[model samples]
Target: MYIAFALVLLFIGAEGLVRGSSSLALRAGLSRLMVGLTIVAFGTSSPELVVSVEAALSNQGDISVGNVVGSNIFNIAVILGITALVCPIPVHRQVIKVDAPVALGVALLLVLLLFNQTLSRFEGVLLFSGIVAYTWMSFILARREASPASADNEDILAVTQSRHWGMDIAFILAGLAVLVVGSRLLVEHAVALAGSFGISEAVIGLTIVAAGTSMPELATSLVAAFRKQPDIAIGNIVGSNIFNVLGILGVASVISPMEAPGISALDYGVMIMFSVLLIPLLYTGRRLHRVEGGVLLALYFGYLFLLWPE
Candidate 1:
């Protein structure tokens, strides 16, 4: 019952966030892709940042690395896959050429850092610095590309302006409130339930807790797909994954360095594999088809099989 209620709040909160954030972007004459990458991505990623920080401060810090690695794997394989199945999400060429490659590079960098079994304070700063660079780069790129979008973008922008700025601000704040509260409720119960099953902290953080915190991203992307905003849909996943690795991991480490307690290389390899797979899979047709989505989802379950409680 609690799980169901929490999901309801997540869904509601995501709706408001997508609506308000997307409106804000359009009103600003910015591309939906930019809004999806920044606003929606940050909104959804808030849970990861909060949970990881609190856990680090409390000394249960091992979960930080596990949670981040697992969440990134899940985002592309599960969230993006499922959204693709909904409407066969279209991939932008820039994403294939620019965004996906950067995400992959970051993934490789993460693998090397994790090899040491410790994310040091200095490394945390480097990762956090990347966040600043990536955000500004995205803004510059988006503005340059905005003019090429067809008249449809103009129509959407006009519609968004019909909405009062005050209402949009209210929506953003209200959405954030419910999203945070709901994520907390869900994470607390989820960890307890996983513990009852004798699940390891690493596994719980990697699977259940990670998935719970990612509810907003899942909801936001699914909504974007249903609304026929393909750019927003895929952008949310790409953006969230980048945020998960760079922003969330960086801050968590700065607070308390991350180490994957008892986490195996095979597990880390699985995370890295999922990240690498995005490149070719997306490039095949510059689209993620329903069949491919199924393939990705199947791979996610396979990873879970490897982690299933002894």
Candidate 2:
């Protein structure tokens, strides 16, 4: 019953968030792509940040670390795969040139810092700083690309003018709140279910909690794709992955240093593999085709199959 309710909430939340965030972008003369990369991405990733921070504070270091790593993997492998299958998503040059590399870079950095299985407060600060820098750069880029064609701007303006800024803000906030609540309920129940089967905390965090917390991204991205806003769809996945590693883990570690002995080199390798794979997959035809989507889905399920507890 709770699972069904959470799914409903997640769908509603994703719709409101995508609508409000996209409309806000139109009103501000910014591209929906930029809005997706920043606001929508951060909103969807909030569950990961919250779950990780709480786990860190509770001294569940394995869960905290595993959640971030696993979510990053799921975001690319599953979220993007499903979005692409819904409709072939066009890859923006900015994402190829800037965002994708940044995603890969941060993933590498995280692995390097985690070689000793420890994340210190100082390293956390460094990672946290990356998000601030990335956000600032995005805004700067948004300003440069704010001037969409006059006809496109006019059409967007007509559609958005009826909606007030206050309503847009309300939609974004309410959507985020609902998403977080729904994600929490799902994750709690999922962990309990997994624990009933004797799954370790680290494995539970990596497989169940990670996917549960990422439900928002999956919902929002699929909605964006359905709405024919492919930029938002793609950006939400890439941006969320970046935030999952740099922002979520950074904050969690800063609050309390994390020692993740249960997160093995294989987990980190898989995360990095997904990160690296996105570059060519996106760059190949400048669009992610259904076949490529199938490949991603296969790889992700294969990984999960191998990871499944005996």
Candidate 3:
């Protein structure tokens, strides 16, 4: 019952967030794609931030660190893979040149930070600053490159013009609040259930907790894809993966230094592999085709298979 309720809330929260964020972006003179990359992506990533912080506070370093690492992997492989299968997502030039490379850099940075198997408060502050800089750079670039709104953007504006700006802000806040709560319930129940099967904290955090908290991203991206907003669909995943590492982990490590002894180098390697693979897949024809999507799905499932016993 709790899991079912959590799913409902996740769906509703994701719907509200997508509607509110997309409309708000159009009104604010930001492109829908930028909106997806920044606002929608950060908003959807809130659950991850919450989960990791809570785990850090409780001194469960494995869960805290594993959650972000696993969530990033899931965002690229599972979320993007499923979204591409629904509709081949166009690769934004900015993403390939700037955003994806930034994502890879941060993943490498995380590895460096974890060299001592610990994330110090100083390291956390540095990670946090990267997110701030990244967000500022993204906005500056977005405004500088602003063009006339597309038909889709105009249509969204028209639909939302009837409503007030306050309502949009309200929807965003409410959606984020609901998403955090829903993901908490889902993760707690899921961890409990996984414990019954004798799953380790590291595995539960990497797989179940990561997937549970990422439900918002999955729902939002799928909804965006169906709504014919490919930028939002694609941007949301790339942006979320970046935010998952820089934002969520940064905040968690700041709260309490995390020691991730249980998270092996192989886990980090897999995460980097996925991040690296996206570039070539997206660079080819500048679109993620259904066949590429299947490859991603197969890789993701294969990774899961490797994680569990025979």
Candidate 4:
């Protein structure tokens, strides 16, 4: 019963975090794409980030690593897969030309760092720095692209005028508070529940914990897809993938060095392969039609088949 309640609360908290943060971003004059890419994406991934960091600090390094890697796999293979199945996500040229490459590059960097089976603090810093630099560059590009003829500028100004800046800040702080508290409770209960069932920590991390932390991403992506905002749909996944690799892992490692479990090599290999596989679909000039969406969904199901418990 406690576990069930924890799950409910986890989802509720994630929903609150996403709603508050996305609203705040909109209120702060951010463009829809920027809101989706930065606020929505980061907001959705916050639960995973918090959980991974806490796991690292508590010395449950396997949980930390597994949570990040599993969530990324789930984000692309599961979330995107389901979204595509619902509605074909159109591939924007900007994402194909710019974002997909960055995602691939980061995945490669993660593999290289983990080659020795451990993530050190220095590598963490480098990864985090890269995220910061990428964010700065994104903002600069957005500003440059906003023209006198573009409606985005009007949208930004309207958002800025309608809401009090203080209220926006307050909502952000409150949302974060809820997220941290909710994550702590969920992780504690999840670990305890797994122990009761005699489940390996790694397995718990890979499945239950991973799924729990990914609730926000799942919800946000589903909502975006339903709204027919393909840009947001694609951007959310792309940005979350980057954050999972760089921000979540980076922060966790900095909190404490993480040692990968025996199965991690297999997991990492799969993650890299999936990350790479996404490149072609995203890079193709054409949109992700139903057939392509079907293929991606099939690949995701195959991944799950391989990981399912005996």
Clashes of each: 0, 0, 0, 0
Candidate 4 Cα errors over 4 Å, as ranges: 18-30, 147-162
- What 10-residue stretch in candidate 2 is worst by lDDT? 153-162
lDDT of 2 by residue, 1-310 (tens): 6755765666567657756776777688765545656866886777677678877876778888889999998999998999889989888778898899999999999999999999999999999999999999988876676565323323322234226888888887887787767756655665566678887778878887788678888877776677665656677788888888889998989999989988877789999999899999999989999899889999999888877753
Write down the TM-score for model 2: 0.84
RMSD list, candidates in order = 3.0, 3.5, 2.8, 3.1
Candidate that beats the other on lDDT, 1 or 4, i.e. the better one: 1
Stretches off by above 4 angstroms in model 1 are: 1-33, 150-173
Model 4 residue pairs with clashes: none
Candidate 1 TM-score over all chains jointly: 0.85
Model 2 pairs in collision? none
1 or 2, which is superior by lDDT?
A: 2
lDDT of 4 by residue, 1-310 (tens): 6555655566666556666666676666677555655766777787788888888887787788778888877787778788877777777666787887898889889878888878899989998998898888777766766664235323322223225656556656766676677767767777897778776666677777887788777776677567665446677788888888888988888879887763456677778887888888766654665666777668767766666552
True-vs-predicted CA distance for residue 171, candidate 3, Å: 3.2
Ordering by TM-score:
3, 4, 1, 2
Task: List lDDT for all candidates, in order.
Answer: 0.75, 0.79, 0.80, 0.73
Q: Residue 158 of candidate 1: its Cα lDDT? A: 27
lDDT of 1 by residue, 84-163 (tens): 89988878787899888888888888878877788888888889998889999988887777665634433322234435
Error of 2 at 261 (Å): 1.4
